[model samples]
Target: MRKIFLFMAAIISAFAISAQTQTIVIQGPNGKLMADLSVPSLNTNEKKTVAILMHGFGSNRHRPLLRAIYDKLSECGIGAIRFDFDGCGDSDGEFVDMTVPKEIADAKAVYEYVRDLPWVSDIYLIGHSQGGVVASMLAGELDKDAVKGVALLAPAAVLREDAIRGNTQGAKYDPITPPEYVELPSGIKIGRDYIVTAQTLPIYDAALQYQGPVLMLHGTSDIIVPYTYSLRYNDIYQNGSLRLIKGVDHSFNGYEKEAADIVANFFINTVNDYVL
Candidate 1:
């Protein structure tokens, strides 16, 4: 009878997990984009907090690592939403013509939309790679009251700086590329019509002054963005700290299970601290 009960519990748990996640498309200030929303199965019994996941540059909402993280967060009872930034994912926009400001504007729109969801109790932002910069900007200047915390995973210290130093190998996919040879991922093509050139300094600078609790994580083995960047960001922010994961890389690469655990744990703990 005990074994039978346990088997039934497992089947119920699987159903619950599947019901909590659904693919969605939303219209932001710029245009429509693809997003994946997930929630913990147990969360339906009670109100729960939410964390929004933003993927890295040259990536989309369906990246495996991010999907895994979202799944884990859902299992832990936190609601999650991951989307492709305008012009980047299933959203409508010209990727090369986009600037940092445009992306930030889109993120702001997402924040507003998510906050209005009937099931949300609180909202948090979690970003990876370039997405970290977007989250940081939103955390500081979001026009909404629902946003409660910020989390950066290998976020770029200075987006431009990271770009200048990024592997030219990856530049090829940039809908807009630097004067170097490299392929960008996610179909970001580089061309002369680039709309987000360095003049967008206003957006980048504004991020430094963000006002909110921040949590940064980076791995030492990350060749994409240095772990030192996360440390510096943590040092500068009044309400944050950087946790270095030894031997980890930019995408958390081979550390999927561990990375998901850490990201979910951070979401839980960060929200807990803010409420008190």
Candidate 2:
């Protein structure tokens, strides 16, 4: 009985020390958005840097990779905020009809939301898959001031190309399945309800033209977005760098720990001065 009591006490104490994680809500112009904000107590009293995590298409902040990234960032003494895109998770709006333009606006709303925080000294953006594309378009304007550099995680190198894959005349619904693709669980389908905007091409171009100190990380075997996306765009940034992990897939299979470490190192070492 004494051992059982001691074990329970230890579990309770463990939870108390890691209570830095919290779910927070921020209001957009139209409605409210929810996110999990967590930071290690390293600089709890002092101002610390912040990173906003943007998840991929059809994924909210609750995605496994996002949560893993958040935990990784928190352990590295960096404060991170991850939220659901509009119409997904706890955020307002409809995602079925959402487009890149509207999603970018939502990204901007979240960025603005982070900017208003008192303890945030630097605002960096970390995005995965399609989220990386959205972050890239805003890289220039978002980094103008207060915003920092951007991290592109398995970004869709050719977003419009991917978006139009079976979109004959922008009509019809074809699942984004593949022999070489990441093999996302069943029931995930391309959102055909959305109308592709001209913004997609421009965003792709801007992502390739972005000159900031961008860190592009992609799995070598990622067929979903393909690692070539990062390789082909390496020269776009004057200070851009790429790290292609070996034997990794689109979702970075079996390598979340390594991926998280690489991401943390980039934010710490590369993005400090890039933060405007």
Candidate 3:
């Protein structure tokens, strides 16, 4: 009777350990950024690889698309961390102060935090839209050995072009004399610094510096960001591939599962290849 009770207790403990999620707060360039860290309940003692999920512009870390990817990665025995940018979601900061450079700094902070974990064997980045831009840049900036792979979904590299044209997010402003702040249709306020900084950023040049496996997914019907942008990335990356999803929007709305599976499989394969 005692042996049977002990066996049942051990099995329950193993089941509980298979999957776990935790709410964590990490310091960002501006302030605190809230995040959810999800780990698979694998019984192995080996160090695990983790993917950091980055949301699109004006979106929070808990956006449905991000959450869906996070769960899918966890189900695949991969861990994931999704966090809000400093000005968005539950993080501390004003949205008006947000910029591409600032968000890059925020991403670096999160990367450093995750990199120091003893249980993390490798790190990968999965970013959507603007977040994808940040991930690409950061992967380049970090030591080549630090980031094993990068996955971009409908990356919005058009911001740089829009800034140069003096029209960004449907608001026209003099590039040389932008206002201290401009409000968008959604009532989100962005500073002129954001425009000036984006205009001068060598996004592609910097992103292509990271020599790692890259996976880019874009939808043919994504009006916001043309699928050609991803094709351009594929051309730039030495070891990159692009997949065009048919008739889907920028958000991959109805094809969340497909997107998540692609990301998870890419990371899984990258990790396996690295190990071998």
Using TM-score as the measure, name the better of candidate 1 and candidate 3. 3
Model 1 global lDDT (CA atoms, 0 to 1) = 0.71
TM-score for predicted model 3 compared with the true structure: 0.91
Candidate 2 residues lying further than 4 Å off, grouped into runs, are 1-19, 40-45, 165-193, 198-200, 208-210, 273-276
Over 1-276, each residue of candidate 3 has an lDDT whose tens digit, in order, gives 999999876764554468699999999979999999987665556788889999989999888789888987777667899999989999999888899989999999999999988788888999999999999989888887888889999999988998888877787888888889878877888898898898998889989888789999999999988998899889998788789999999999988988988888888775458531
For residues 1-276, what per-residue lDDT tens digits would candidate 2 score against the true structure? 999999876764653465387787877654677888875454455777778898887788977778777877876667789988777788887665456766677888888877777777777788898888888877654545545677888987566765447332233334353221222244333344342452135765666445657889998888777788887667666778899887788777677777777888888787775633
Instruction: Supply candidate 1's per-residue lDDT for 5.
Output: 100
Task: List candidate 1 segments past 4 Å from native.
Answer: 1-19, 40-46, 143-145, 162-188, 191-205
Backbone clashes in each candidate structure, one number apiece?
18, 1, 1
lDDT of 1 by residue, 165-237 (tens): 5433354334344543333564456433232353244434565566567778888998878887787777667
lDDT of 3 at 132: 94
Model 3 scores worst on lDDT over the 10 consecutive residues at: 267-276
Sort every candidate by lDDT, greatest first: 3, 1, 2
Q: Kindly report which residue stretches of model 3 are placed more than 4 angstroms away from their true locations once superposed.
A: 1-17, 42-45, 274-276
Best by lDDT: 3
After TM-score superposition, what is the CA distance of residue 196 in candidate 1 from its true location, in Å?
A: 5.2
